[model samples]
Target: MFALRRLSTVALSGARCKHSLPDLPYAYEALEPIISRDIMTLHHQKHHATYVNNLNATEEKLSQAISKCDVSTAISLEPALRFNGGGHLNHTIFWETLSPKCTEASKDLMVAITESFGSFDAMKELLSAAAVGVQGSGWAWLGYDPKIKRLRIAQCANQDPLEATTGLKPLFGIDVWEHAYYLQYKNVRADYVKAIFEVTNWEAVSKRYSKAAC
Candidate 1:
């Protein structure tokens, strides 16, 4: 029985090694009437899943190349690993930082936001504009700036992780990827940005802020 349990653990870890998608904490339809069920399902199961899959595959190759000391092969795989890995990481955080209702921001989170951006409303305006004004596929993030000891809103193109690119710890992220909102809000990304507030998981965000500060 001990041996069997060990094998099961190995199997589970191996499965995770291949970049399996993280399960959503809530149902696909839970974020309605902000995000549609169809969009959530496809975005999570298809788009985000693909990134996770590709990242895992790329990492496997990277591991093999590194173990074999094949510098050229490892170098060639860097772009793929960075892009897909960053996508998976960012989306994982994004999913957790949202819910299905307009929950109040945590008091601690509110205090942080106020300290960083002057007020929650100010933070909202800046984050919303940053998200909606993204020229193409990208993400807008509320990140902790260690240097300044404050939160800041920033944007990144493609699948670049906020911390890797800007040295900020990501507290929350808005996926401006068209696939995130195209099915529901079409080309009007502003509508999606506006609606996202309803499902913003401020409690989770507050915890991240606290951790980052520490």
Candidate 2:
């Protein structure tokens, strides 16, 4: 009986460890005018969901290797875990950092942006340019440098997590993957970049900044 109970516990733990797609706070259509419903639906339900699923699958294989002390198999799973885990993390933050309603920058976030970039407008220009200039599929971010106690703009190629690549803490991010804007804005990525700000959730970004600072 005890052996059976132990086995059940291990199985349950493994099942609970699997990565799952997180639900958005708002409806798929809520971000309209800036991001179309179709884009949000497909991007979240399909693209991000795929990453979460794959990450879970890869991690399961990795766990089995670790339990057996198979170093080579563990090492072989690194790339998939990084790619898929980073995708899940980045997309999670991306969805949270936006809203349909236009909001003023939070006092804390605004102050940091002003102090670091000299003004919010400057930061916007810099971040927007980075978003538009990504050579391929990537992301543009407004991140906080804890060591410098300042804000900075950075870019990541593919699905690399911002914090993992740079020491900066991501506050807000914009997805530059063609899949992000191709359907609605087509090849006019500049327009997509321009429109994204209209719905930027400064409140959420501010919370992220505050948490990172802590």
TM values, all candidates: 0.90, 0.92
Q: Candidate 1: which pairs clash?
A: none
Q: Kindly list the per-residue Cα lDDT of model 2 for residues 2-52, writing each as its tens digit.
A: 787667557755675777899998899999978999999999999999999
TM-score of 1: 0.90
User: Positional deviation of 119 in candidate 2, in angstroms?
Assistant: 0.4
Candidate 2 structure lDDT: 0.90
Residue-wise C-alpha lDDT for candidate 1, range 17-117, written one tens digit per residue: 56679999899999988999999999999989999889978887776666555899989997898799999999999999998765676787788899988
Residue pairs whose backbone atoms clash in candidate 2? none
Error of 1 at 153 (Å): 0.6
Leading candidate by lDDT: 2
Q: Which regions of candidate 2 are displaced past 4 Å?
A: 1-16
